[model samples]
Target: MDALLERIQSPAHLRQLSPASLQGLAVELRERLIETVSKTGGHFSSNLGTVELTIALHYVFNTPEDRLIWDVGHQTYAHKILTGRNLRMGSLRQQGGLSGFPRREESIYDAFGTAHSSTSISAALGMAVAAQLTGSQRKAVAIIGDGALTAGMAYEALNNAGASNCDVLVILNDNDMSISPPVGALNQYLAELMSGRFYAQAKKIGERVLRNAPPLFALARHIEQQTQTLIQSNTIFEKLGFTYTGPIDGHDVDGLVATLEKISKAKGPQFLHVVTRKGKGYEKAEIDPVTYHGPPKFNPSLGVVGAASSKVTFTHVFGQWLCDMAAKDPRVIGITPAMREGSGMVEFSQRFPNRYHDVGIAEQHAVTFAAGLACEGLKPVVAIYSTFLQRAYDQLIHDVALQNLPVVFALDRAGLVGADGPTHAGMFDIAFTRCIPNMSVACPADENECRQLLSSAYAQDHPVTVRYPRGAGAGVVVEKSLTPLPLGQAKIVREGEGLAILCFGPLLYEALKVAEPLNATVVNMRWAKPLDLKILQEIAQSHDRLVTLEDGTRMGGAGSAVLEALQDMGISRQVLIMGFEDQFTEHGDPGLLMQQYGLTASGIQQRIEALWPVAQVTSALRRVV
Candidate 1:
């Protein structure tokens, strides 16, 4: 056991320590975080960044009573360590263990359950409102990153908070890097040179003078306002109704603690702009936060490393296709909402610097920005996570789909993303994206298909989305040559006598397993939107039973599509739908989750076994009748 880990018994223990002792504790905590997280493989860089800030927040505020909401929640590891979760840190992100994100169920200190970005303000505002209504003397503090503030939702919350005049403290953790370092800092910096004590005192003196005097004081106040604006211009945040505070060094614990303590007593909505490095203490992560954002378990000394096999992932397939497509067509433009490394755009970005756009952590902006780019002759490809794309649904519909703009949306993590849990799962893209008019959705069965579909989406001038799951491909050799296949068509993987399994995306692999034993015909329904009716009708006429399977939500998924197709055709074939139930999946290993959901090869085979016996029994009953 680490001696440092033992010292962090509680936040109270943290409060008692002097500045020098706390600094030593921070180093110890950083070492413990590195050792455990390197083995457990949770979020690294952001947690490393927020160590001192977390310590200061606890030291300054009365937590459990005072609400503190972390924007992304991954950065709350240090907060968790301080708030009586130090022992459970080793089991971070594991099943039945500490969550990677903040969980209200786990501790009272975790005021809100969070994983998605830019939601802390809204949640914190709600907490403030609740406290006000209940007559609870609890202060609500929302710690948000400048990157998350780029999202329109954050501004919406700020507008509401300012109008309501709720006593909420919003700390903007600005590092000029909100996941990616390319997003430079914005806003004023008077608080940088002047101490918080001086600023507070000056504010009091100005208010007193303004109350007593008339003409000369009014003139002085106007001059002072102008001077302050020139020195520390009222940025967009202040205009929205927040009392803008800082661009302070977030790493300075004593400075942060003192500032927060002073501001905690203030009576209105306050915004503290504290800037810190992303991968603060660890040099490797500090230098390359984007790459080290969510690295797998590894030896910390060797630095973060990728898989040795160089197994071609679906993401890699997209990357190659993007670079190749951009090379061939100058009009093709690539855009990502600050996911350059994860979405596999590094090579393409390097190759076509002018054509590629990293639109910070603003999904809404990314969509509209791409839509504007599309108004010209440029074909914009917005690569984003399936879960994150949920944020841009309105933008996609209003800006792209309604206008019928040529925006190729590459939806990454288009299935059950393991370990990240319900908030991170790509379960609803099929249901949600399908609802938009003039929108085309495609899912690939393998790596080769993923490349070809992307090529197809780019070739089309209308709004098209191609979604692919995370992790490596099905080991299918992808071709360098790009070709657009006929739209609304499904391919048959095998032929059978009785049962037909219609599988979409990743479920194709498992469906094949069920098919191999039972000799069932399997159709890889590549397109999720335009249901492949020709094959569906053919199979309905031939097979007595049809099984539809997918990795997404069962509601309005590929199974539902097949059922709708058969219903529209008036061909009442006995169809069995299989996929995720209408429930949020918990965090676990991908394989474990798959098995739990009965979406695995053996699990599918067991279903086939039960159905095979039923088929025989039904045939015999027909003879008896």
Candidate 2:
């Protein structure tokens, strides 16, 4: 069975296998995926679900020639394995290793690089149109999850694709899950489509009538088509001009292959709805798909064990703050674009279900919706990932900031996100948000500061975003009280001579580590937008040189704010701006990435030493004395 998998190098080889052999191959592929992901700690349940679908698609389609775009690309582990990357699975999501999501740079089979959701249909449609224009026989396919269908972008693409009359296949992989269990009317519509009695009966009647009638094969097919059209004429996909087919079993390899083969030969836009269990083959994943969705490296037999950590994550701090603040204020409402568990709002949703809204992967709508809530005198706290917030920039500027709505944005994952890579990194939020006219950006230093900043952001009248990193900060005790910190004030953590380090966000600790050795002063610049000019000027007057440290991009970031302020104040001091360079960060361990990018303590020290040597610092200290 293992040899069967090893022999197949690409989809070309996969196509060579007989239809009966594919079932065995799918099993082997699932086993290989589970084994690899168990050790690598990448996406789990989603990958398991797509094993058969991936195999069947690759087997049926002339891939590389025919484009296949996967929406939210996390379920491409099996796709990667089949696309000649099986041997490299050990290094999945590691530094310079295979990406957790589909990446065009990694393989030719990857039609489009996608970590974000609801993008596949648009990309696939573009490819399909291009192929049609070039007079190419190549087909385009977009395998989008049911969860992705919630976003308005998917519908926009569908509307266009249907009208274009191009030969494109859009397979809706309905697993009834997308990170958190999918919500909204779309999910309900899909469920209704799957279980509707009339449609099911009509399909059954067509199949039964067609059975044992080889002589009337053409007649039987026509009857089935007519029966399906009568029943499914009102379907959303059909209405959009797509020839909608199936609520078929996604795990049935032969069935999938047969359906795909038929669709491949047909013309015009096609929509195939395939129902799949999120964790089909693996029992542990199948039982609890959510926990296994993106688990850490775990023992396959024992499964993902919940080990309590002493350090409190910034997300937990925000969750706790949201709950506490909601308890105090009746106007408080929590909003997330389908990230309940990811944003640590699970407790808040449970406690205040009415006030909590998971808008389902629709970032633009989430922002505008929060703005509407704010207009109606409700304090809408949009708990969103910094990366996801980019999707709603127009909404943020027009709906929220332009109106100066008091919507508190709790931006989780505000820096290099490690394994998820550049596509998911929240490095540009500070830069982007600061430039927006009426928006305020807060960068918390630690766990306690994160809670305080959330409170502070909530208390503000205008739109404010409190940005924090992915995991736990420096284990500072988070205070229980909903005390708002003084807005836009910089806190002096340590006072020294010669040089001063203006640190933004959690990088304050890294600056502190190098402060003592370099005889430097450390100032925690809490707010990126409303810079504390008073404290900045004071620090500049006292120190010989200044350094601005942030976890975001160097261009137009928190450091840039400091520089612009200094220039306006006419303070001519030699300053070093430190942050992420103009490049997409790679997938790896966060600490290692920090070191590589010279964001760690030792790395900071080295960068500082290179600019102003130990001798220069000593001389400056002597002059100060």
Candidate 3:
């Protein structure tokens, strides 16, 4: 017989299978998921954990017509497979391949696109309200993890969703982990809710009621309502206007299907708590789900092995610098919004347990919390991703920058992050941070500069952001001493004639390569906020043409800052600004993406030659002469 997974074309096919056959389909789905991810490398444990739930959801729900939104969307591999995308699983996160997250453009089954966490409930509520307005019977369900529930937006949506009494269903997939182990009062409340005597008593009461009652619809309703009332007094969801159900076993496809069927017919907002284990079927992943959360391609039999790399990543440099800085200054505190592992703060967290704060997935609270610490004479370093920091823009401006608080923001993954796509890219950090008053932005060129600039930012009295790319840079040897670089200063690395390239961040290496062949002067503009006017004037006067390069967006970016400064300085040199255009970049290899965007060395050379053909010809003639 053909495999159950091979025969299924869509949810329609999935729904056709017998209740007994559904478990076999789940087994096949898990096998397929493990096989594909072992080769392609993606959200492993989360996707593995969601297999049974995905099966149950698709089996029970009408799908496509009935909207399904996956929060953080990393665990949607099974969802994709069931929705007629099994063959394309091989291309997951590859160049021009399937997105790791749910994208509306990818399929109709992906009702709402999500990469960032805690957005599903809000989006689902909006869709549910829309359905109400249109007089449709289609249901909307938002499946969010417990880690995502840490965000305030989820509660804000919950408050509105409850009061509105819409047909939105919020399914809490309580896996007891987000990216990091789940934290906060909510997590504690959930643990208590699951283990408390009330839940146990309610179960006994319901079971006893079911045994004695007549096999009628009214009796079933009476038992359900009675058991719910027992549990409702203890639940926060019930108070928020939701009919709370379960702390049920998510892996039991039969139970999930039965429960979902019952909930589907219920009126008003619904909150179902389903407990699942991360990396449920896989033994190795079950032991250490975090390491397997997003591992590289590896053999499933051997599991993931730590492969040593010669190159030091910027994340490592930051982590090392953080530990060193903390040792020297007792006032130094490290904080991350549930990205302690991602931001390279494991060592710091281990060494300074008291000072280390993982503020869950709340970006807004993290920034304000850092600001509050700074007010009390403690220096707080908020190590966060460039994209994630966008969530706390208002907190940054109002709490940190407005007060001129000395909060050092270590903006990791500051530029085009490979594979994660535009949602995770740090393209706007340069433009966004520079515009804010009292917020200085530093663009480090290499690993050594990253450490030095971090020190410099730390030394400042006001809020400063030191932006660095995702991976390793030019492999510059980092200095052991804690030394601060001069703030708002540019360094001229090379001197040549005809053209000068002002490079920012890690793109300095690419600029150097372009400059070598053209004999063009290269200046590493360290700061994007306080433009190096003295160096800009000299570069402008000495060179016939100027070019600005960065890894961020062209509009209002570091390149734009250069142009604005030149305009103010009354310099008439023909300047060409080069950076990412005003478009969201796609998920692909970083090197390939850079080449496609004309940000690589050869690509930069081609653009320069094309833009200034006459200048190139004149330079060639001069060299010949």
Candidate 4:
């Protein structure tokens, strides 16, 4: 049979399909998603859960004109497939291929670019307001997951959205899970609301009797109101000024289509709660969604196979260090913003459940919460991604750094995170963190250094952050002992003449590669802040040319800090800075990105040869011959 999905080039075509045919299309879509993701290795469980919802949205709503915003767009693979990109499913997340998230440039249907969570409501509200002002009949809808609602921004938008007169439909796709199991009051409230028999009975009984008798319906409504008064007051959404609907089965395509058909015609702010199961169709994924949340390339029939590696990742080093530190120091505590597994804190969390805190998707709260713990004489270690840390910049500066609290931030995924792309990339941390007062930042070059730096940060009385890259470091033997490195120091890795490369973080390994070919000096500048002045000064004085290298952004990065130090010492040495360029980096293989950005050994060597005219001429002449 020719699949109905192939005919759905756009939402316009989707509107042509019969209601029963939409169900078959959904089956084909789910199978397509499972097969495509198994080969491509993209987001799995979330996409599976949103299959019917995505189909229903495009089928009922006039997309491209009527803006449909998806929060934390990992589940938009089905949306992409339905909206004319079905054939290109094979190239998902590849270089120059379709992005994992919704991009405004990619299609007219993608009204807004969204990779971060909790912004869909605000973006949709703005679009709704714009439509109202322009007198357009076009509607705006925000499809947000229950997990994304954990952040305060979602509520702030909800508070404003509920009060406004704009036309917008806020569909709450409740799967009872975010990336990690959702925590806090919101999850509890939704759980209570979903399971409460009083509300369920009232809804069922009130609607049945009202339809049966239109004349006595007004009196029946009064009785239903009396029954409601006996229970709790109106729902949280009702207070926020949104007309509430559902707790509907999201997998039921016909029900979803019918409900959305009505909501599309309604005016003002409307809220619809749809219940879904993560990894809905796939059996293995249904049993263990977390394992299937994001799996590597695998055979779908056999399920995801585990691949073993001997290399110890930097995240693993921090996780082990956290356990060791907690064991030695009774005051040691660990915290993650709903990323216990991703941050490599699963074992620590299992071992020390009391000492571990997972503050669900709230980075700002996590930072301030850590600050509160530090005030009471307990040492708190915040394990967060570098990109996510941007969300808590104000909290870090105001609550932690301002008070000089002894909070150790073990920043995992500190550089170019691979397939997840720019949205997940940890490019701006060095620039942002280094500027904060009373904040000390260290970048480790290897697994051994990562462990030592973590120990060093924990030893400090003030705020200290140990920033390391995503995966395993340069295959170095990490010692079991917990020893602190001297703060604000640099290690002279190699010695040569004429040229010097002062490298920061894991890029030191690449620097060593380039330095060996040129006989250039290499200094592993471990600390980004409190720049290793003594060693930098000596290198500047001796070497005819100096180069500063970092894996972070070129603008106001670690290399820029080195430039400021040289200027302070009144040195007029010729210097070249190398790092990520001004534009946002695209998603691809991490090694390919590094090579393209000129961070690899050969790339760095070529850049150095460009600076040294004699070497450049010799290289060019040799190539010609």
Q: Give lDDT per model, in order.
A: 0.83, 0.91, 0.91, 0.89
Q: Candidate 2: deviation at residue 36, Å?
A: 0.8
Best by TM-score: 4
TM-score of each: 0.91, 0.96, 0.95, 0.97
- Stretches of candidate 4 off by over 4 Å are 197-205, 212-215, 229-232, 615-625
Tens-digit lDDT track of model 4 for 415-532: 8998889999999999999999999999999999999999989999999989999988899999998989989999999998778899889999999988877888999999998788
lDDT tens digits, residues 98-133, model 1? Answer: 888998889988999878898999999999999899
lDDT tens readout by residue for model 2, 162-244: 99889999999999998998899999888878876566647667677767786686787777668666654468999999988
The 10 consecutive residues of candidate 3 with the worst lDDT sum are 616-625
Model 2 TM-score (2 dp): 0.96
| Poorest lDDT segment (10 consecutive residues) of candidate 1 | 616-625
Query: Candidate 4: global Cα-lDDT?
Result: 0.89
On the 0 to 100 scale, the lDDT of residue 166 in model 3 is 90
In order of listing, the candidates' clash counts read 0, 0, 0, 0
Model 1 bad stretches (over 4 Å): 2-4, 16-20, 184-226, 611-625
TM match of model 3 to true structure: 0.95
Error of 1 at 609 (Å): 3.0
Q: How far is each candidate from the true structure, as Cα RMSD in Å?
A: 3.9, 2.7, 3.3, 3.6
